[model samples]
Target: MSKPRSLDKSTKEDVSFIDRQPDQLTNQSVGQAEPEVPTGSDCAIAQQSSTQNINALPVDVLPPRLQEIINEANICLGFPKDYLAGAMLTAMAAVIGNTHTAEIMPGWKEYAILFTALVGSPGTNKSHPLSFAMQPLIDFDAEQAAIFNEAMKRYEAAMELPPKDRAAKGYDTNPIEPKRVRFTMQDVTPEAVHRILSENRRGLVLVSDELAGWFKNFNRYNNGSESEFWMSVFNHKAAMSDRKSSQSGVFIRNPFLCVIGTIQPKVLTELAAGNRNANGFMERILYVFPSVQSKVRWNRERKSPSFDIAAAWREILSRLIGIVPAVDSCGEIIPEDVPFSPEALDRLFSWQNEVTDRCNAEGSDTLTSIASKLEIYAVRFSLLLALADRACGDEKKLIDADIVERAIRLTEYFRVTAAKVQGIVSEDALTELQLAVLSELPGTFTTAEGVAIAAKCGMSERSFKRFIKDRKGVLFVHSAHGNYTKL
Candidate 1:
């Protein structure tokens, strides 16, 4: 095992784990495009594509229980394993919330939080896997809602009584409404999210089925204030906001938010809107975009897994939720520090040095920004993986070398996928003629076929070859000897 390759360079090594290809789109199901149910051939394509590309998620880096869940979900629900794995990672971070942090040194600490997006075409089964991963948090919020509703009824009944009567009825003359405890929020406003975060210090996860709206709503309220709020929360920094509706401003000492959502490949341009690309917002996101082949026909005969995936996932998250966070005298959460062992720290330092060197050597700002974020993510991932192992009964006290090694592998997987997303975003920079030529080409074609298609667009063979060669990872990915695929 050699160390993971530099982010600036592509690796030719044969990695074992299989994931979808990056940026390639399969045909949409005719009319009313419904959910895609992947068949055995989907797995075959995944296995074959892993040999040719490094964009796939390294599923083996995950914990054993999570591995089982991904396998069972794919077999039973036909959800893409890549999507499930990515969603599960975000789910775990949300569950961890602000309870724990990975302390790299005296001053540097990272929380287990992430902003992830699952990018795919329609009917690729992105939503289902995400729903499956986040069901536990949803269930927890539902329970809280029920509790709040009952308390509100009591409060309302008590409020109907006169001041003296209320006291006689064992109710306070003045009543404070019970604050709702929510672990997950969807389709919410920025101020609403801030108010909720102020009430519930555990933090919140924003789960959106379509992230296009998330981008579109960036400057909706106060001209980039919402975007700045999100960027601050991404770093777990202190957040304070004062609005006209509130007498007192809302303040959070350590604001934590983990966002997970899905968007189509064509929506990548929205990411660049509002200067998100020019800023660090685009780099903070981790994208799961699997290259896929044709959709598999629905198989009614596919059997469900013997073990219950939902129950297993619930149990795992429940264990994590049960871990109580330490609080200071001021009633603020004090994140429990999980430091790396000597060996693990050494391994982490080595990986960070390599990433730093790669960032220094790379010219592409997109890739460099991604590498820098992944450096922080590397520590966050190690903490999450270690705690997840504990939730699974590993009982490890400190982050070990093996866990750090796994985190490095996991970080590399995201590094590749983020590059793929950058490639998709770069397509927005394509000229009209290039976009026209790409729209005309097949999903996969030979060089001769590409030349013929280019000629149809009135492009010469020399120019066509130059276009293909220059846009190797962006507009197209070289498939084989003289073969290319539109990305």
Candidate 2:
């Protein structure tokens, strides 16, 4: 309205778990800054800044080696460093798999599992970084495929023998087929996923180049069971999948599946389709949506780093994969619990209280759902970070307060990104005229002011009233009598 009045300059409150104050960090030295310990006043300042200000990933909070790899990739290889960091974090979680989990208490455990997406437009270099981060798993899958192929050849020969001759030759007449040991899956069905988790027992990562297909094909085979299966896997819950062709179904206890992929910003709304936004499916995902997306210019003078970064990453993952998980007498893999230290437990509890308070204070379901999920993510990030540090040779016996503080910062980053994504999805759903009118409204507005603004944007008074009425809890939240707050 009135040419959108050059857009409103009034600030809206940002719903975030922690305030960003780089100067207040515990270790502010030049090399690498440690996590900032928030004070009471710092928590009050959480809503001070716009979430758009936090586009860069808090790389310093990561393990030193990981920070190095991300930096080298950014400077030398022209990859988006934050994209690499996000994908790398998920890949690391996949590598750890069901081997270990972070336990805040005896009954509260968090697995190193995540569902992450790198959000940008095409040609933003989203896919390459994902491939680099997951290359180690890809190689492992290739090795497993080779082993499976050789075993299949032998099994086919064994099947050719007569029942008695095959038994005499130390091969069962009905030889068991070789199940492929896999670390990554691209085209997978729910039953296939359950079967793989059953055979591997360590879990796997689902690598998708474009998440649009992943969401659009949720009901490709069945009515809508795939979406529920995915949600169950996200929580590492026990699940069973029955195929009509088989008399017995595949049953997996404690199924673990990590997902990492890239999605265009425009395609984000599709992710919220079919009640996903309201049903907590979207809340379970951590999105890495940078404020700016530009292709890195080609630097002719750039040179690859002398050391092999991929090799370093591969070695770290190899060490994690080598950690043999304990199993029960029934042959189920048992995850070792890495409990938090007393100080860490206290710190995490305090932060959880802060999140709960924020959730209680918010009127928007989207924001509250995201805040609740971030509480869970904070614990998972702590486990992933603590274990990554251990993998980087900074061994720790337990999750410490510093690690928890680091996880808080990581969670805050994701919180801001999630808010940014919500904004994108909501904005995409608005019409051009509606968006123009919305831009003209300030952080707070009255019905008369909104009517005046919409009038200038060529919207009828009746339409403006109906638009505001329909968008309650989405574009606008009722603040008071005749007053609304733009979300």
Candidate 3:
């Protein structure tokens, strides 16, 4: 392959300035200063004082057999052993903090976007993980799960609920009925989303497969109020007005609900740039891109476990709901000595700065938007980590550098990979141009011939020459005859 092209003159100059004055470029840290750890006595006192009715269901009460099954199933689902521990810890934290509520409430987390995309080739069981593997963690009961499934079906059918006849006797008049509604895998409308949140108050986990398909629809309707509605729901704090009795002027807030979506990488690329969906909306999501290599294919020749692991997991998760921590709000439980190193913090901030600068320079507003989304994801992940630690009976609420490192790396991979797919950098185009020129001209060529070759490759002579020069080591003078030769 041809050598990679260097940055343009202006970009090179900017890079030089950065290299010469690294302190000037990244003088500040991205997040707040690490808090000091509390003493054991302090933690105990704090836990006793602020203890709420969060843990209605205690894990100690769970049967050992069930616990073992849960552990084994989690492993089967391909979750790393460490992450499984983290998940348990997260559940424990939620139980301790507000047993009734998950600490990472959608809007309360302060993420710019709440987006989650699962990417892999077709039939990689991508959607199954979100729907079956993770869904049960939310703890939907049989009846509630049935209702959720139906809601998805109705959503897919595009069958709007018939307008209620308020005057009819024996007809339920409740504005939001407790009906099991499943969203159509295809039709993800603003109205449908609004209804799902409004009716499913106990918290609903909306899962969709082939996200690229829905993303296309999102783009088609990404104008006017439709887009606004989508953004408002994601804001988490925003409440939707009652569609059915505006005269009553009632508004409802959805606190417990969350969305988990799965999609292929190609679909994500299309949705990220092709659609006019604001970067702000995209940034609010916790993107989990599943690896294709990790997919477990089932065939007739090979039999795998067909047990309802989701059902089992849901039971475990349901037990965690409404469990709040019994700790003081101000008291910090993390050990100060175990905090992330200054160097780790520095690296994180540097990465954030790099992402911000690149997004700004590329004029891709989504880059900055994703940065905000990533911050929320990081915080949520941290909170989960803290909760998991506390659940494991660890006294500290502070997460170590390893957790932060993993979160940052995950966010960066998604952002950088997405940006590349969208062709945000000129590197791809330049590389293609260079390859084309090399392929056509095997020997030295005059300026006129070079321009002709460039024209044939569908680029302007100016652009072609600039690429040649910017590429540096690849181009050389042939006897200074206003001709160039491949080095």
Best by TM-score: 2
Candidate 2: pairs in clash: none
Comparing candidate 2 with candidate 3, which one achieves the higher TM-score? 2
* Segments of candidate 3 deviating more than 4 angstroms: 1-113, 135-141, 144-189, 199-203, 216-224, 241-257, 265-274, 277-316, 324-369, 390-395, 398-402, 420-456, 461-487
What TM-score, over all chains together, does every model reach? 0.80, 0.84, 0.51
Q: Per-residue lDDT for 204-317 in model 3, tens only?
A: 444455555545555444244444455565554556654442343334443333444555554554555533334455555444432222344333443233566555555555
Q: What is candidate 1's TM-score against the reference?
A: 0.80
Q: Give model 2's clash tally.
A: 0
**For candidate 2, lDDT tens digit of each residue in 296-406?**
556678778768999988988887877889999977889988878888888788877867775565445676788788888889998998888888887676888778777
Per model, how many backbone clashes are there? 1, 0, 41
Q: What TM-score does candidate 3 reach?
A: 0.51
